[model samples]
Target chain A: MDFWTLANALATGLLTGLVYGLSALGLSVIFGVIRIVNFAHGEIMVMGMFFALIMFRWLGLDPLLSIPLAAAILFVFGYFLQSTVISRVAHLPDHMQFLLLAALAVMIVNACLLIFGPDPQAINISYSFDSFDIGENLIIDKSRAYAAIAAVAISGLLLGFFKYSRTGKAIRACADNYLGAQVVGLKVSHLYALTFGIGAAVLGAAGCVLLLLIEVHPYLAPGYTLLAFVIVIIGGLGSMTGALVGGILIGMSEALAAIIFQPSMKSAFSFGLLILVLLLRPQGLMGKSVK
Target chain B: MMGLNLLADLTLRGRICLLIFLAILISLPFWSSSYIISVTTITLYLAILGQSWNLMLGFAGLLSLGHALFVGVSAYMAAYLFSVLGLPPVIGIFPAVALAVLIGMLIGYLGFRFSIGGVYFALLTIAFAELVRIMVDHMGLIGGTEGLFLQVTEADRQGFDLINLRGHPWMFYYLAMLLAFLTLAGCRTLLKSKLGYYWQAIRDDQDAAQALGINVFRYKMYAVMYSSGIAGVAGVFYAFYQNSLFPESVFGIERSIEISLGPIVGGVGSLFGPVLGAFILTPLGEGLTEFTDYLQSSGLIDPKLKLNGLKLLIWGLVVALIVLFKPAGIWPWLNEKLGFSRKEGE
Candidate 1:
């Protein structure tokens, strides 16, 4: 309501949105290239968080330092997942593919539950609860700021990779037109594995950053999966910039809705936005219209 | 006459198989344990849900992931009426069905009008279901997060009471069986109708269907309404049988997924697919839970190591294997292997 309070909410929303953007980037990329909605993306992200938690708790490493390791591990896991299991159903009907992903999601979530138990775990770095006052009544949490910074840096690196690397260009080409890319001698299946791996790596890094700010649990994947879906739909499916913008918009609207109503209703706002965007503009803000 | 014709259409082998299956089910209470009867009741309800879902997903090609919305809302509606208004479930179910149909049409309109098909349509359904679930969780009027319980009197629980829908386990079992039978018959009838052809056409190719002058939107809406209505019937049965309603249990995404699995595993478009799926899946699911409980009680497995995830893990593996192997589902494959003529209008 007040100026500084509003500004603080805005800042918090933007920072949180960056994390959401990072989380959604992999989903967008996978969808863009493979034309498959990876329902297990969120579970993969949670796996990353668990990986980070393991590094921090058992090995006495900072979660921030564990990001790359977690990402690398997830990259391999995702690559194999696509190459082995997902590729089997790559040519199946749309609903079958959807069911496969849904099954994978259930498997991963429950598998994590079996391994980790149902407890919520968080990484406790030195600055976990520390915050700094920027100006007037506006303050920023140290972990949130650090997470946001990491998200932005990772996103920038991804953008650079997509722009400059040959593999990235091949991925883009495959996403643009799979048949054309195939005609041009792009190993589409191999590229698909690589793209999925990249997506998983991004989600892994985002998960590490997320663990710095919030608790992680086996059940956490569905909510984030839904959130990423909302963000991607709003931003335009398969567009990097769209995911970032959409994530921020969702985060801001959620924050604003929390200010207006109850915090429990934040998801209502996001879902509402998703339905609206779906009905009014299925193409989304920055994506091409779906045929 | 229609029923006679349908019966007449069956081959001698089909008729004999049907008679034997019916005899088995009718005599179940006499020989099988109460646990098996209850599991059968659950399977029957799941069959209804799966068949209902198949009407839309398999025939109409509208992939809906939020079917729990219909079941949950209808159950809550009927439960609320029974508890607060003191209305019997038989009467309460009518309005619940109406509400479910109305909601189904609204969603169908929104989805089909915008040409939202495939996964996008599924997401739309999920969003609506989640939105409703969250809202219901906060609404204390209908028990909110704590849930509502139906009152079952001693007399009602002891014997058959058709009015209040409170009776022995056999009573619910019979009711569920009748419902499942009627639903199967109804689906067969629908599939034989012109609307069924239109649905299949639209499912096969919406653009091509449109070119053929089929009213795609209207037929699709009909599918949604009919499917939701059937699911609403299942919900009413659920409320009366379970005698309790929880937003999390009823409206959860897991519930939606569970409802869809029967149809997916059985055979999506086939008439007997849902029934076969439910028969296979429900017992397996219940058996896993019972096994885990037994293991825990017997100290065969560590109590500290929670096996809560084991059932779902197995379910996931089963579903994955099915999707990978028999994507057309088990019924059609079984039908082929058995050399039975395919069910009419599939």
Candidate 2:
């Protein structure tokens, strides 16, 4: 590929990777705190996207401005789900827990399909079409740039919260050692609900930004769910920074792969990379071995 | 002889029920309409797939979310051999089974060798299935996304043609029934054997199994191979029964999820759980579709209204409730209520 073309692919890939990172970060945080892989993470993201669409269309609110509202709504929803349904199965065997999440995924996706219909919806603001030319050949969509900036900013805020906030430390304590956290009189279940709520809030923000970039549909969740899992695994399961790096890596690889091969084969590349990383480094690039 | 011995072990009531169930299955073609026959055929095949999945998930304590990979691979293999090579499906099935087993072994080796168990193993399987689906969609050799349609000759379509597996609905129905019975018998025998003990051991506690001198990896490989092999056979049946193979319909995550539901909703690890689950789920699913069609046709529902999403929503709710309430599944609970002797493996 030519220099400008390569640079353009890298830029697009990096930008898209920011969104992927943001999405994967939700899954990472959920796994980190709750110790349960939310199979419905992408569905939750799609739910956020739909929520944004609703607010944008019905209330005449700008999609970007609806981010906090959507995040708050999703946070409450996550807290409810964690406290009610997930906590019941938290003590079950691994397979049962997995099946519960899978069932939840089915319920959420199908529920969305029932309510929203199967049609793909997109919000077309003025910025959705606008792009800027950075140099002779490289061009970036304005909405995507804004989404990327939002993703980075959100990641920063999440990192800061986890590092400096009291609730964040409590969540970290619970994640680090569930039993020890309990011994220290930290209400483990409450902490879990809070962590899940934060994770969902992150996804809600990502969904608002994603609305500006792509179409939303019920079936959109599964692909994103799989991608998020791959990114989470690649970045290390519980590491926030790892999720960002892994997302960027996957995004760049997929973009470059599309240029090199058929566009359809890009998913294959991502899955292949996932399998390779899983086989070679189960602990992930940024994760430390627990054992 | 073994079957007879198994029959002898059951109570007289149990034996009678077994005989009656078999008789009903055998006579189904005589009294049932073609629609019922087709549904039953699908249920039987689903039972087979569920049983196969149960071997890994229920017996070996390994959950695979991408079993459609085996099904899709074998179905495509059988379809390809029959269409491109002009071979009979009966002959095509061998290579299909072999290919499925090969793939199963590859996955098992990669997974078990690296000690990848639990949810990670499930994710690996999902990734493999997706990768295969994408590759198959792009490969022109398999007709790409347009899919490959198997040709049925006039003679084959009209009567029982064992070679091409093209015949009336009853022929496929009987074939499916036989396959289901054989799979049940095979699973029952395996569950009674020493291998079953080793599998249960590994499933319950892999470290303890290793400490007790069981080769956890080899037995786990055995479970996967057997599971994939059975799934491959079901795929061959599916190929001929459907008379077409598409990458999306066969290899999609939905297909995997559908196959797993039978075992999950029915009861995992029980011999009859998959069969019972298939009977319950297939009829409910098909009945919902039929009901929706009836509503649309009878003008009760608007012509423009789409009911599939709603049907799926209800189905999801049912599955969720089942998972929440009866995590061990309905079979074990039913077994207790019916006063049947709950065998250890069963």
Candidate 3:
């Protein structure tokens, strides 16, 4: 392809990748702290998107403005979820745990189906079509830039919280050694709830941002879950930085694949990339070795 | 000697149960409505799929999230052969099964060779399945997005065409029943053999199995090959029975879940688990939809409101509850309740 087209695709890919990375980061945080892969991740994200959509429809709030509201709501849900149902299944085998979360995914998706019909929902701000030229060749959409900026800001905030906050350290301690934390009298279950809540908040904000770029529907939940998984595995499961980097790589490849091949083959391209990463380096670029 | 081989796992009581069950199935068409016959046929189809899947996932601990790939590939292969070259499905099924086995080997090689197990291995299978589905969506010769079709005349629907594989529901029903019996017998025989023992070894603990001199990689591949081959068989039958094939309908992850629900809910790694699970789930699931339809038609519920979601909500809840409470499934518990010994090698 021409240099201009290539650069444009690259820019767009990076922007979309930010949002994708943000979504995967939510999953990564969950896996990192709990060592439990949330199979219902995509459904939860759809929940966040719906949260945003509902607010936008009823309250005339911009999707961008509704990000924190969605995140807060999701955080509470995640907290209760971890404190209750997840605690019960935490002791099960990996496959059983996966199935349990997947079941939860099914329930959540169906709940959406019952609440809102199967039609895709979207937010149509006045600038949905607005774009700006950054350089001689590269043009970016207004929504894409805003979403990317918001993603970076939230990611930074999350990282800072993980690094600097006492609650973050306690959660990390539990992840480092749950037994050790319990030995030291840390409220491990409550801490786990906090971590899950934060992870969910990340996804919730991401859902709000995503609604700007695409439509939301219950059926779309699984595909997003798959996408987050693809991103997380590529970056290395349970690695936050890995999620970001993996997201960009997949985003770029998919964008370029759309230009190189048929648009429908974009997912195939990412999956091919995932297979390569899985076979060549199952641990991922930034993650530790798989035990 | 022939009789002994047939009685490999079954006790005398079990044999009596089998005969009685067979008699009931044989007499079903005489008394039951066409709807029940068709539903039973569907249950049988699910039993076959679930039994095949259990061989790999339950027996070898190979979690395949994309099993529909095998079914889809086999169905499309058989459908294409029949539609293009006018070959009968009975014959076309061989090549299709062979292809499915090859595909199975490809996935197994990728998974087992790399030592990818558990959910990671499952993810690998998903990638391959999704990849194939996308590629197939673009291909035009075999009817890409629009899907492939088989010809059916008004006469073909009412009367049986045993030769060309076009037939009435009775033909398909009998074929499904035969396949179900074959799968049950095949699994039973395999479980009694050395290969089945080795497979269960790998499934329960790979490292320990390897340390004990069992070739974990080889046996796991065997599980995948047999499972995928059987899935292909079901696929070929499904293609011809439906007289049309759609990519998403056969290859989608949802289809894979549908295939797996029987084995999982009925009980995994047990021979009769898939059968029992299929019998319970298929009828119940069909009934669920029918009940929703009833509500919509009777104006008890909003006609415009879609109830499939509510149905699925209950379905997922049931699956979750089963996984939580009856992890071993209902079959083994019932088997024990009736005083039959457990079926697994260990």
Candidate 4:
């Protein structure tokens, strides 16, 4: 590929990667602290997208404008959902937790199905189809470019919060060692809720950004969720930077694979890459134990 | 007192229980219509799926979210062999089953080798299954997204004559029963073996099991292999019974969830739990749809209730309710409530 082509693909990959990073961050936050796999996280992201779509229709708001509202609404929903339902399951044996989470995921999907129906919803920003030229040869869709910037900015802000803030420190402490942190008088339950809220908020942001470039549907979240999970696993669990790196790698690989191979082969490539990475380094590219 | 003692006699109890079970099984065809028979047959296939999943997830404590991959792969293989090559299903089943096992080994190796445990491991399996489904959907060699269909004859229709593969509900019913029983027996035997102990040990704590000189990864892989093999057998039966193989129907996440539901609800890690769970849940699930259709036809409920998304709400609620209330499973809870715990000695 020529320099322009390579750069364009890389840019596209990075934009898609940012979305993956956002979603993975949500899951990583939950996994990092609670050590529970919120299998329904993807469904929740879908729900968030649905909310954003509703906002766009009812209030004539842009999807990007609905980001804060989506995050706030989903964050609250996630917090209560976890505190009331998921927390109970978290205390069960690990296998039971899996079963419970699967059950929850099913319930969420079913609920989404009931509420949203199967028809896909796409948001077309006026500028979504418009592209901007960078330097001499690189061209990028304005909406996609905006999405990439938003994802990076959101992720960067979250990382900054985690590194500097008080609640962030508590989250880090609880995730690092739940019991030890509890021993030091940290409110583990609150920390869990906080983590869940953040995760939900991150997904909310991803949902908004995604809806700008593409559409949202009840079933669509699982695809992104699974892909994001692959990214999280390959990125190394609980590592934000790893999630970013893994997302970019997978996004580029998928883009390249789709260019060279058939569209259907892309999922296979992503999944194959996930298995390969898991086999070689389960700890991930930037391997580190969460605890 | 003497009458009570007589009623409680061991021989009398055995005879009564056995007679009741046999009566239920035997009279099913007589009392129920052909439609019910087909339902039962489908339930039996699901029961096999549930039992297989329970063995791996419940007993071994290794979660696999992509079990439908096994069913789909085996079904497609069998379809290709039986239809394209003009091979009898009896002959085709072996290679399909073998291939399924090989795929299981590949998945297990990729997963357990790297020690991907818990939910991440399950997600890996789900991803793999979706990948397979996507691949199959796009590949035209096996009919692509249009799916593969087997030719049908009058003999293929459901009836008494068993010479041909068609129209024999009884064959499928009996085969499913036999397969379920065999699986139960096989699992029981494994549970009694040293390997079973190792599995339980590893499930409880892999590190501890390793410390005790057990090869944790090998045993876990064995569990996955056996489970996948059982799913393969069911896949072959399903292909013949349905006479079609669609990527969505055979290999989708929905199917995987359906398979896992039995084990989860019936009580994982128990011999008959998955069977019981499947019989209960599958019928209920099928019944719900039928009931919805009946209601819609009768104009009792809103015609708008026929919408697709509503059922998802009900399904999610049921699963969440089960998880919220009886996480150990309905069967175990029933057993406990009925004081059916095994005696200390045996």
| Backbone clashes, each candidate | 0, 0, 0, 10
- Residue-level error in angstroms, candidate 2, position B47: 0.5
TM-score of chain A of 4: 0.94
Cα deviation of A254, candidate 1, in Å: 1.5
Predicted candidate 4 versus true structure: per-residue lDDT over B138-251, tens digit per residue? 889999889999887775665653333455677778777778767766777677678888888987888899998998878988998999999998998888888888988888
lDDT of 2: 0.89
Off by over 4 Å in 3: B1-20, B340-346
Clashing pairs in model 4? A107-B316, A110-B312, A110-B313, A113-B309, A114-B309, B156-B166, B156-B167, B157-B167, B158-B167, B159-B167
DockQ by candidate, in order: 0.76, 0.68, 0.73, 0.61
Model 3 chain A — which ten-residue stretch has the worst lDDT?
A91-100
Question: What tens-digit string does per-residue lDDT give for candidate 1 at A1-291?
Answer: 788878888889999999999999989989988888988888899999999988888988877799989989999988998999899998887778878888999999999999998999877778888998876588999998998999999999998999899989989998888889999999999999998999999999999999988998999998898899999999999999899999899989988888888889899899999999999998789999867
DockQ-based CAPRI category assigned to the predicted complex of candidate 4 = medium
Model 2, residue A264: distance off in Å is 0.9
- Which ranges in model 2 have alpha carbons more than 4 Å from their true place? B5-9, B293-304
Tell me the spans in candidate 4 whose CA falls farther than 4 Å from its real position.
Answer: A1-6, B1-19, B158-164, B294-300, B339-346
| Share of true Cα-Cα contacts across chains kept by each model | 0.72, 0.61, 0.71, 0.71
Report the poorest 10 consecutive residues by lDDT, candidate 1 chain B: B337-346
Please write out the lDDT profile of model 2 over residues A190-281, one tens digit for every residue. 98998899999999999998998899999999899999999998999999999999999999999999999978889899999999988999
Q: What CAPRI grade goes to candidate 2?
A: medium
With a 3 Å backbone cut-off (N, CA, C), the pairs that clash in candidate 3 are none
Query: What tens digits encode model 4's per-residue C-alpha lDDT throughout A132-224?
Result: 998889888898888888888989999999999999999999977777998999988988887898888888888888887777767776677
**DockQ of candidate 2 relative to the true structure:** 0.68
